[model samples]
Target: MNIQETQINFTILNRFMVLKKKERLAHAYLFSGPMDVGKGETALGVAKLVNCENLSEENYFCDVCPSCLKINSRNHPDVHVIDNEDGGTIKIDQIRGLLGQVKMRPFQALKKVFIIRNIESMTIESSNALLKTLEEPGGNSLLLLTVSSLEKILPTVRSRCHTMPFSALSLRVMARRLMSDDGEFPQEAHFLAHFAEGCLGRARCLKEDKIFIQKDAIIDQFILSSKSEDFVKKILTDKPKTKGLLDILLSWMRDSLLVKVGVEDARLIHIDRLDDLKFFVERYSFFVLNDVYEESVKTYKLLADNLNVKIPLLIIKEKLRYE
Candidate 1:
């Protein structure tokens, strides 16, 4: 398989490539990151690499090999993607069934790979049952758990697996590959890349939800919050969306700082509004600029911590006034 294919994570593949070559691949792995960041695809790629019928001289898989084809079609008998059968909750029974399978040998491949999605969805009883498999994995067997949050996972389970933490994609990376779920690309893909915090899957969700259409209006709110009490009142009524606005507004301030420091346009998140970015850069001195940026960051954190959105947002607006 070509590891460099778009949507596949190359950094992760390369790491696994080295591990596989050295014969040091762990039997269990915990891929912890945002659900939308291609963790599942990475697991499948690793599975293909380990079990491919023919590994190239350079050590990548042949895409047309039987193992590769079976994995691509989800028909590989030994490579299992376990589901949360109890209506989004993995019950003790499902994990017990998995343990039984784990003890058996691979049907065809070099190793059996079981991928369990979002360990957070499993109950305490279910997780405890899973621990047994981790403690004593079958020979030539692998378990891959894609987790939403590390803290939510049982510490015993978390410690047993080799953890691979996925990072959000950069703006430049996202802008380059801006195709959406329906295969339609957008003119504001650069902005969407920045807006979704560079998680392509989340960017697609934001696109479908029409959050892109509201981008300008959100920025306008940031700009007008300092000028009109009535506008601020209207914005406060939609507190949930306002949380998104704070993120955008914080990004705006951050871009403005980057612009003033002569950072290249490519590095700035607000490149779509270059003229506007330049306009804002000239409005504040560096000291005042950084002050607001730090405050906005703290404000965004406060909102994320589940505080009343209006309070921190209003505090940010007062800071945005920047006396």
Candidate 2:
């Protein structure tokens, strides 16, 4: 999709354009949001806007300009990317290296842009190494940092940059984009859109990902695990995709809760599976459904916190069969 067509954070993009037109843009900006929610796309769009040779109101980038093409192809000399290339962490050396480059003049464009993806993965030393550069980044340079959450970033670092909070798109927007992006996904469009948590990019990925189909089978299996004589043994012994399984179960439990409470279909994340969710909701009492939902939430949290997955999974299995 084109830059303007992004459903998430359209207001922020317009604000960036206004700032650029008024010559009041900041030196550093932190685009914090969920993954695949257009933070990186927006950052790259800003880079193009600042460097486009033939920018126009009708189109953010002329699309054919040399500068825009370079940025689009990720070949722009002035547009640098600092990511977790080594073992999933941005080290001190990388920060120092970026700072050294920041000290130089732009090679091709009017502005030198450094797009730092996964800034949350920066080590403490790396964060400190970049503090001075952030504080006094001289010349026509723009620092764009994309992170999933602000809480993981150092408070000092966060204080130095213009933090732009991004949110996921609505179900309708995601579903629409899914169909537009891939016509083949129309049959499963609503399901993937809801499952992606309103991220168009993620919806696209989920559409092509075989693991998603496996996860669906696992969820279905778990929902019927109660009938199996060795449900606990099967679940506890089987090597499950921990994060994916828990996330699907959480969505299922959440949708069931919503159905039980008479929530609007628009508000439900599993909009495509309303009948299935209703079936599950009817099989449990209000308290049992609420209890399972809480357990699902707690188990997901525990898994995210790096706790052992077996205990939590066992707990969820028991809770699921509590009846």
Candidate 3:
């Protein structure tokens, strides 16, 4: 979908549109929000709007224009997406390469735009290098940095750019968007929307994820693993092979924790499995369950940093089994 048809209401989108009309857009902006909430997409939308030869009267991009088409396809020479493509860190070399490109004038569009995804992944050297770019970004150049939170970015970097905060998308908005596509079930839409934690991008990805194939087995193993070592081992083997496993595990722990704390059923992510989740929660003390949840989060961060996943997986298993 194009920028004009966004389901979630983004304050930044309206703010930028005003800036575009006033011709007072900033050189650098920090887009801070939860993952998959469309910070990156919004940055691209800004690029399209600023460069489109035929912007609509409603301040939307004419997606048919050459600039909009190239940006949409991520082939625009003036629009660049910088992310951690090598190893797990955005290295200094990448920043240097980007700076070299930013030095040049726009090839076709009126403004050159750079959208940096997961800017928090930048190494110390890279972050330092980015400071130079942020401080002296060229007149016609725009830098858009997206991170889960401002705490992840350097103070110096954060101070240099206008910060735009995004919150989780509403459940109704996300579910409605999911159901808009043909052949999607309403029941599945409700579940996917909650499971995505208010992120439309995550909702879409979850709809097609292969890990859901093991849902029943995984849930059963999680419930049984409290007493059976064999079940725990099976869960380890059955864990999602992708990074998405952490999200699934976190969701289960979160649901159990919510039940243990007497959170309302309506707020539970695993509403459909409330009975099973309550059963599981009853088996463990609140402190133990909370510790496991904290450890799981730490393990997820380590895994994202390119550490071996098996060690953390075993650690989590042991925590769940004996803690």
Candidate 4:
């Protein structure tokens, strides 16, 4: 997706345009948020905006321009990208080598632009090595760094750059996008939308995996199956796809809570399963549903930090009480 896409951070994009026009742009910017939520795309937009040979709107780059095309195609000499696009670690030497290029004058664009994707993948030494450039950043270059989480970044590194935090789009917005490329999903649009957590990239992957069919089974396992522990153990063993399962279970619990309190409406993610939600709600107290939801969310947090999920699930399993 392009930076100009509706799902991106518009507030920051407008601010960038204003800064660009007034020549008050920060030398370095850190865009941190959930993956595929437009951090990298906006960075690419800024790269093109600063170097576009033919300008369109104050906030837009002329896509047909030679410079824009080069940037888009990764042929722009002045623009450098260090993306862990494949599942690999970004090393110290790679950062060191790129920093050397950062020290040079721009070959064609007005300023060199470095778009470093997934900065969390950088080693401590690599992060430290870039601190000097971030502090001074005197080479008329723009450093655009995208990270999935800010916890891994050194506080010193964060202090040196302009940090922009991004959020996922609304469920309606993401669901609408998913429907554009319809038939990718076998489930109702809003259900997948809720499960996607407002990221189209995630929704696309869900569609690719045909994850819709598993939602009912995941819910049934949580609410009715006599083997919740074993089921969760199997899911946790897989690890990579666990969040999608968690998303399903969490959404179901959330709906159960809503139904318990009589707040059910369009806000419900599992409307088609309202009867199931009602029955599930009747089987548990408000405190139990809330506690289970909190535990599920805790599991989500632990997964984000790449930590063990055992503790949270132990609590969740107790609350669900499949036995």
Candidate 5:
């Protein structure tokens, strides 16, 4: 598929385009954003642009050049893409090997591009070893690093690269893309997009998640069940995995808030349960809902910190019941 038409907007990709046009492209670039937001695709586009033989004024690759064809086929000699190996970690040995290859000259194109996907997977030693090459990048060699979290990288390495921050796709945009692709998912798309918390990749994941349907059913039961004691106990005891359940509950609460405010453009991650969302909004006040949302966020943080999961789950259920 053409990069522009892949449910992502290249019109907004002008920032990189201008850099390429100015002939002042940075030797190293860090594309950091939410997962599945097209960082890897953007990096490939950059590589193709740098190596295109018959470049146009508006576009990067000619799509017909030998180099572009090689890149398309994943056999480009000058373009190297380093990713995780068997254990999904970029080892020191892999870094050393890539650095060794960097010493050699570009054979085909004016520039040799190296794209490292998931730079956060690099070990401390590998990252430290790469610092020198990053600081003093070789002539005709460009490095493209991508990570979901920039803080995971060493500050020294981060300082040497230009950073591009990608935001989550808006609900309207995501919904439109889904409708265009599969009309059956129009309603579900809007809900999933909102629940994804501005992440298109997460939205896609939700579309395929079997647990999402069950989560919707659970939220419905939670909203309607009058016997708080039995309901909370059943839910908490039945699903020992409270963290995931908490995330879903948070999403449901956010969806309710969006529905209450009549937010047409709300990117709801749990779109499949619009009926439940509507019911919750009708039953709860804004203040109460907002409090629940805030507390859920705290619970998420606590879960991340390895706190006792059952305590937060019990507290959340009690708060929902009493307040």
Candidate 6:
């Protein structure tokens, strides 16, 4: 696909064009952003642009050339993509394999490109192994690393490469993209867009998730029911367990704060829960909403740290009741 047609819009494209014009592209680059913001697509586009035999004045690939066709089919010998293997981490052995390949000359294109997705998922040993390659990469080879969580990446790895930050797309742009594939999405597209918080991947995932629908219903119940007993019971008995309910509640509370503070552009994962959000915002003071938001964030962090999910939920329940 052409660079312009990608889901994301930013100065990166223009910068890339300028760099290509000057023939001064970086040997290694780190594309950091939230998931589904077109980082991978952009990386592929860069590869195609760099290697395209038939290039246009706009610097876009002809897409009709042999090189472009090979890249599109993911059979280009010069372009290497390294992803997680068999649901496991990218190990030191895998990095060693890639490093071996990098030593070889490009098979077709003038430059060879190695694209690594989810670099944060690389094991510590693997990251250290890759550091040598990054420090003294081959002259004709380029490394592109895509990561969602920069914190998980080794500081040494992060410092060696040029960094590009990708932000989430606007709801309107996301909705438009979704509409192109599924026309029926427009009405609910805004809602999905809000919930996706600028990440197209999350929006698409939410669209396919029945849990989001159930969460919407639960939020409706929370708004309609005077007593929290039924809502709590339904949450506790849900198929995915209380974690789903807790997640939705946290998202709702976040939206409540956004709405209360008059933030015009908030990425709420539960856009359909606006009524519930409104109710919460109306009933609770800004301070209370902020506290709820903080608690929700803490709960998410605790879960990430392997803390027992029940403890956080119980604490959240008690806080809600106390408030």
lDDT-best of 3 and 4: 4
What is the C-alpha local distance difference test score of candidate 6?
A: 0.75
Expressed as tens digits, the lDDT of each residue in 1-323 for candidate 4 is 34444445677777788898998998999998898788877888888888888875744777778889998898899998887757687888888877788778898889899988998887888888888778767568899998888888888988888999988888887776676656534237777778777876777777678776677778777556656877777878877768767777778888888899897677898887887777778877788889889888888988989998866876776777631
Per-residue lDDT of candidate 5, residues 231-295 (tens digit): 55565554434555776777777777888898634355555556656766776678888887888
Instruction: Please write out the lDDT profile of model 3 over residues 1-323, one tens digit for every residue.
Output: 55535533357777887898898998999988999888888888888888999987765677898999999899999999999886399999989998998768999989999988899999999999999999778988999999998999899999999999888878977777778752456656766888777888887777676435555555665534654455445544643442555676788888888899898556776676777787777767999899889988998887678676666666776776643
lDDT of 3 at 140: 89
Candidate 4's TM-score: 0.81
- Which sequence of candidate numbers ranks them by TM-score, best first? 2, 4, 5, 6, 3, 1
Candidate 2 lDDT over 68-184, as tens digits, reads 999889999999888888649999998888888886889999999999999999999999988888987957899999999999989999999999988888877777777776674
TM-score-better candidate, 2 vs 5: 2
* TM-scores vs. true structure, each candidate: 0.75, 0.85, 0.77, 0.81, 0.80, 0.79
User: What are the per-model C-alpha RMSD values against the true structure?
Assistant: 4.4, 3.1, 4.6, 3.8, 3.8, 4.0
Task: Report the lDDT of model 1 for residue 103.
Answer: 76
lDDT of 3: 0.79
Query: Candidate 2 regions off by >4 Å?
Result: 4-9, 184-187, 227-240, 261-266, 305-323
- The clash count for each model shown is 1, 0, 0, 0, 8, 2
Pairs with backbone N, CA or C atoms under 3 Å apart (clashes), candidate 6:
195-268, 195-269
Question: Residue 128 CA error for candidate 3 (Å)?
Answer: 1.6
Report the Cα lDDT for residue 205, model 1.
83
Q: How many backbone clashes does candidate 4 have?
A: 0
Q: What is the C-alpha lDDT of each candidate?
A: 0.79, 0.78, 0.79, 0.79, 0.73, 0.75
Please, what are the lDDT tens digits per residue for candidate 6 over residues 1-323?
A: 54455653346656776788898998899999888898888787778878889887855678889998898899999998888867579888889988897768898898899999899889989898889999878989989899997897999999999999989887787778777755635557776676677677777777678655766666665433455565666555553555666566777777777889875353555555565566667777788777767887887777667565555655665555534
Judge candidate 5 at residue 111 and give its lDDT.
87
